[model samples]
Target: MHREIGPLRALANGVFCLGLLGLAGFGAVQVAGKNWQVQDTYHLSAAFDSISGLEPGGRVFVQGVDAGVVEAIVPPSTPGDPVRLTLRIDARLRPLIRTDAEARIVTQGVVGARVVEIRPGSAEAEILPDGGVIASEKPLELADLMQKASAALERLDTVAGSAEEGLAEVNAIASAIRGGEGTLGRLLTDDEPVNRLVQLTDRGEQTLADIQDNLDALKNTWPISRYFTRRGYDDRDLALYRPNASRKSMTISESDLFDPGRAVLTKAGREQLNSVAEWTKEHLTKKTEVVIASFTDNSLDDLMAERLTQQQAEAIREYLVDNHGIDSAGWFRSRTVAAVGFGRHRPRMISAEPQGTSPDRRVEIILFTPQAAS
Candidate 1:
């Protein structure tokens, strides 16, 4: 009985030892599978405009040395096209990676793993510490570069075609203009037009010469004599040409005609003139009151106040003659002459003493026959 009891205890002990060995084996396997060096790895993140092809578990290298692997590739949080990728690398090589160090995706041999490679920048660059990020030079994937190059080539082709078309159109337009095919054609090709222009120029010259001759003949006459030949009178009718030879004399009653100092006529002088005109019309013969309200003074303030010019005043005079009721008589003479002469004589001296009186500023005239002498 004692021998049988000892055998049973030995069997139970063997079973318990086997069980412990099995548990130890499982723990070892878990440790081996963990594979990550916790204290050694440094973390960094890089952003790309577009990460078309990249995957986790891709190898990370520093100047060809295996440093780390890609941890994650995060898509852009926003709507625009951007991507962010995270990497974990060993901390021991952090001093080798400068702040200016760049990261890029490169392939191993022919069938090697895709890797995140670092090209250590200048010696002047600061060494990148553990978990510090180095800038990523964009990954050079052949397919993406090819696609962009293809698009650029297409745009270049389009621009070249447009430039060719523009050149052709410009050439055609220039050819047409040179050939004189349109309205410009007649201007360039017609010879009769040139002849007609020459004839017109010659006629203009002849007419101008005739006018100059007539002017020269008129100037030869005296100051008070007529400068134009009578319309109905001819050379044979020279004796019949009663050339207004008699200088009709008259006395001026109004004192404003000769002011104290100034030569220019005044506004009050103009009003007094009109008054004399009214009196003459009420009691005199048929004579036109041609009152040209001429403003010839050189005063900028007066021009501004009136806001009308000499040209405008002349236009008003023309309008009155053409549209209004001012009559035209054959001969012009002084109102003083009319007052003293025989053609329905009437006279009145218009007073000059009035408010807002501009002195010696206007003219009043009356028409009369020389035969009607006082």
Candidate 2:
């Protein structure tokens, strides 16, 4: 053995050493990436509702810096208990890991490897003790999204079924009429009978129209108009009245609201409107509507009365919405804040002689509710 080594033997020895060196280097690199330089690892525990896809040996970062590794996940000791995970953080960084640190399982990149990230708490906080239970945030799970989607689909299916049933009923009624099954069908099918029926309907309609006209006339009668003014029917059919449709009303006189012929509201009017705003916010539901109607006297004739009333209504609307935050949407849900001017005379209210200079030239704020909630 002491004799001179052969050239082939020496070459084989060199290759063997290089192979050993390469293997060691590869293993060291893997260990370093996994444990972040592999110093003494202090174990910290945390609880999560769900970790998503976290696994052992996954890298852990504190404040986005390389810090530790995930060690183990312990199944709940009791039912309903959160899953506990043991985290091995670098001992040197222990001081930086405060008791208030929160751990969250997250992906390195979108669709990349998963890791545990610790939120470094305030520097003034006390250091977390060894084996301390840290707080954790659960990552969003696909199962949760799927559950919500399923619930929404169930609701949509119910609506679709109801709509289909409604359509079917409508079709059945349409088909029955087309087959001359009802009185309406006969009117459409038999010419002589239909003709007689048409005449009867015409007569009946004319009779009702005449009655309506007469009622309109009586509605303008002197003392009766006073009651009508108090009750804002606005051409409603007394036969089919629902008292609950309109809940309440507040009337502000034109004299109190505006100065003489000006359309602008006076300071006192603003104060009155502010009170209305407070009442609406406190008592009115989101589905209630506000109706503002204006009236003028017959002293200015038809056209001028209508125009002045319209302008006054507009002015009141601008103040309520611009200054008080009333809605401008529609007839429903705090909407369609209607403003109508009838000049100095509202026939239904000022029967014999118009309230040419009196409080009839006023705006009424009416609250209309669809139906009272049970």
Q: Against the true structure, whose lDDT is highest?
A: 2
- Each candidate's lDDT (Cα)? 0.50, 0.70
How well does candidate 2 match the true structure in TM-score terms?
0.36
Candidate 1 local accuracy as lDDT? 0.50
Per-model TM-score versus the true fold: 0.32, 0.36
lDDT of 1 by residue, 1-374 (tens): 45455877899999999999999988877663343344467688777776554688777787667777778888888888667778887778777778898887765653456777888777788887666766877666756645655655565555556555555655665676688766666756887655655655565565556555544444433321221221111231131122232222112322443242233334555555445444444433343223222222333345341333222223333333344323433222222121111111111332222134432222223222233445
Shift of residue 358 alpha carbon in model 1, Å: 99
* CA displacement after TM-score superposition, residue 354 of candidate 2 (Å): 60
Pick the TM-score winner.
Answer: 2
lDDT of 2 by residue, 1-374 (tens): 48998999999999999999999999998878576555777889988887768887888898677888888888888888988888888888898888888888877754688888888777778999999988887775546645655655565555556555555655665686678776966557779755654655565565555555555555554345545453333442221223556456667788888887778888998898888777765646666666667775556777877777767877887787888767634331235465666575443422122234436567777666678657
Q: Where's the lowest-lDDT run of ten residues in candidate 2?
A: 346-355
How many residue pairs clash (N, CA or C atoms closer than 3 angstroms) in each of the candidate models, in the order given?
A: 5, 10
CA-RMSD of model 1: 44.6
**Model 1 misses residue 167 by how many Å?**
33
